[model samples]
Target: MIADTELILNADGSIYHLNLKPEDLAHTIILVGDPERVPIVSKYFDTIEVRKGKREFITHTGMLRGKRLSVLSTGIGTDNIDIVLNEIDALINVDFTTKVLREDLRSVDIIRIGTSGSIQGNIPVGTLLASEFAVGFDTLMQFYVKSYTAAEQKLAEAVNRHFSNLSFSPYIGSANPALLKQFAMELPKGITMTAPGFYGPQGRSVRTHNMYPDLIQKANSFITKEGLYITNLEMETAGIYALSNMFGHRALSINAILASRLHEEFCANPAEVIDSAIQYVLNRI
Candidate 1:
């Protein structure tokens, strides 16, 4: 089943979207939201094999502690994730040049190191959070053919009720369990509350009238029966987690805390916080 765009490429032997080629990548991939931040994370690399950028997507392939890795920018949202994820999967699992599904598909470990705000006051700025779960609040899931079980449906219904009462839609998502067992001990672990944005979507104070004033409280207090708390708030975790899980890939999110929604103050120096997060994940992964 070859798609029309079999070999996604640029004129100079670079990838189409990422502007990179096979030799320019490594098995371990780290995804970041901002393209400018790609080099910041890759700076710690022992040796940089390649560097390429296309539009909002930037990639740096190198070695860190002798672990071959690719640091790529997935831009700001889940929409960008769809392109990068599919292409990376095609490169690793499907053999893009030939457009053939490899008999033995190689699974690349993906880690998202991003900045986020804390819904729970306990998680203050400058702390790094690892998402054990992600509650999706985006449109990426509608693309997939879904068949939710009765139990799953009930949970979704409850989530809907909670959102409807508050007049905001909360996406239900979770991180890769395999990743949790691997690096859970390294960072402060909790379920990440994946939000759609930093504005009114997350109950941020903009120029317009916003929804529930107790949005963060509602999120923090609404715990699943098994005891899952909404710990962090970011844009793409739910989409990344959901899609990666559906495709049989492992994914984890390590968030550098920038603000506390409860306290309403962003970290004075977010650069140091994000830097610390990168080092932590690099060492752990």
Candidate 2:
């Protein structure tokens, strides 16, 4: 049984951060980074059932084409993902009222539909890409004991060697292959780099100076001995992949290219691009 201090609940007994209960979610879930995008995905539902919100977390449960699913927003970076993923896992696998682990574990399918910037010029703006692997530049995984597989270790080593000058090391996480096989048809598969922030971490310079000015270019050119290179840059996929894997859930990240770092281009119709990707995911699921 988890202590109250560890698994905090609201006055109504909902998860503290997500404000979700066991009955509020579905077996299959779709996660978006923006709260507004929650409705964008749920709008395709044939019948809507649950709609709840608190803070940046928003959840909508509904049926589409007779398939029941839940859409929830994680809101921006891995920091938020840390709260969302654990709470959702607790909702399903833990007996919240008793604060005890259930005999039977439940694994949910988590798909992140997000917009990203292509690190490689060839990926092109407005294109949809599925993450085969997610490289995390954030320190989220460091807080937990090691959970990386052998393949992830090799990838992390290669990334570390490539960027030896950096003070911190990056970790690598892979997407669920079953989910990837189901949805990756006609979608280009590439490794995604999940930055801690949209600014300096992603090599964007504003009022503050960038520690790695050539970060984007270096990331673009980095190729492992296995011949894998980064395809896109986003702020959430690595955390989603890592946490979902840790909690025994299947996860995938489908990206809509809104910007191109190599070409210095941004999508003219970003909303339409995201809408198209959402529809594509809806059709596949």
Candidate 3:
């Protein structure tokens, strides 16, 4: 049994950060980065069952075409994902009343529908990019033991070799194949690089000077030994993939490209593009 300090709960017995109970969630979950986007996804539901929010976390559970699904917002970045994933796992796999794990574990499908900037020129703005693999620029997974797969290790080595001058090591993670085949078979597939932040981590500079001036160009040109290139840059997929894999959950990230770094083009109507992608995912999943 775990201590209360380890997994703090509210007075009503809801999870500390998410404020979600086991009954509030569904087996199929659509994760968004923006809290406001929660209702945007849930709007397509036939009947809304639950609507809950706390901090940047907002959850809406309902039925979509007769399938029970839950859409929850995780705000942004790997740090938030660290909290969301672990809490969701605990809600289903652990008995909060006794602070003990259940005899039988439950795994859920986590599909992240978020926006990203394309590093590759061919992938234009408004495009929907399905992450076949996610490369983490952050050190989230490094804190966990044996978090990467054999394929990921090989890809990580190649990525490190390409950006050898960088001080930190990057990790690679693959999306669940079953989920990918089910939801993203016809979509444009590529390796997504998840940055730690919106600015310098993604090679964006305002008043501050960038450590790697040619970071975006190098990332765009990076081709693995197997000839796979990095497609886009986002903030959450790698952590989602790694943590989901560790917890036995099926994870996939579907990105709506809002900007093209190589072409220097940004979507004129990003809302429409995101809505279209959300509708597309709803139709499939």
Candidate 4:
């Protein structure tokens, strides 16, 4: 049995951080990085039945296309992804009252519709790209025990070699094959690089300077032995993929390219681009 300290619950028995009970969750979930984006996606729902919020985690459960769905905000970064994914998994796969794992495991479909910046010059702003694979530059995977496939192993080795100048080794994670094929089969697909932060980790400069001045250039030039190149940079896809796979859930990230580091371009109408991506995902669901 899990300890109370380990599986902390609120007075009302909802998950500690998400403030969502098992009944409030839907099997199909959409994750956004901003809490405000939760309503943006839920707006298209035929009817909203549950609306819950705690800190940056906001959840909306409703029906769309005669199917039940829930959209939640995970705030930003892999750190937040770690918290949100683990808690939600526990909500589904564990018997909260008993504080034990359920006899039968359950799985959920998680789709991340978030914005990203293209590292490659060809992938321009405003394009909706699906992440087939994501390489995490963050340390979230260090604490988790993950077994990689031969393809993932090869990609990880290639990325490590290409970015040899970096202090730490990077980990590669991929979208669930079934989910990728269902929603993003026809979309442009690429490997996404998940950075830990927005400014220095993503090669952005404002008030502070980055240690690796050529981080973006290196990421742009990186290519795997199989000829896959890193296409875009974001903060959460890698963590989402890794944790979702670990928890026996399906996950996919659909990105709206809001900025281009290669061409130094930013999307003029980001709201339109995000709405388009949201509609694209909603229609498929």
Please list the C-alpha lDDT of all candidates, in the order they appear: 0.78, 0.92, 0.93, 0.94
Query: What local lDDT does model 1 show for residue 18?
Result: 77
Once fitted onto the true fold, the runs of candidate 1 whose alpha carbons sit more than 4 angstroms away are 5-8, 12-14, 146-158, 166-171, 211-214
Candidates 1 and 2: which is better by lDDT? 2
Query: Against the correct fold, how does model 2 do in TM-score?
Result: 0.98
Over the stretch 1-285, how does candidate 3's per-residue lDDT look in tens digits? 989999999999999999998899999999999999998899899999999989999999999888999999999899999999999999889898999999999999999999999999899899998999999999998889755678988898999999998899998889999999999889999999999999999998999999998999999899876779999999999999999999999999999999999888999999999999899889987
lDDT of 2 at 284: 89
RMSD of each: 2.6, 0.9, 0.9, 0.8
Reference-based TM-score, model 3: 0.98
Give the candidate number with the greatest lDDT: 4
Clashes of 3: 0
Off by over 4 Å in 3: none
Which 10 consecutive residues of model 1 have the lowest summed lDDT? 146-155
- Residue pairs in steric clash, candidate 1? 15-20, 134-173, 134-174, 135-171, 135-173, 136-171, 136-173
- Residues 84-154, model 4: lDDT tens digits: 99999999998989999999999999999999999998888999999999999999999999888788889
Tell me the RMSD of model 2 versus the true structure: 0.9
Residue-by-residue lDDT tens digits, candidate 2, 50-149: 9999999999998988889999999999999999989999999999889999999989999989999998878889899999999999999999885789
Clashing pairs in 2: none
Please give the TM-score that candidate 1 achieves against the real structure: 0.89
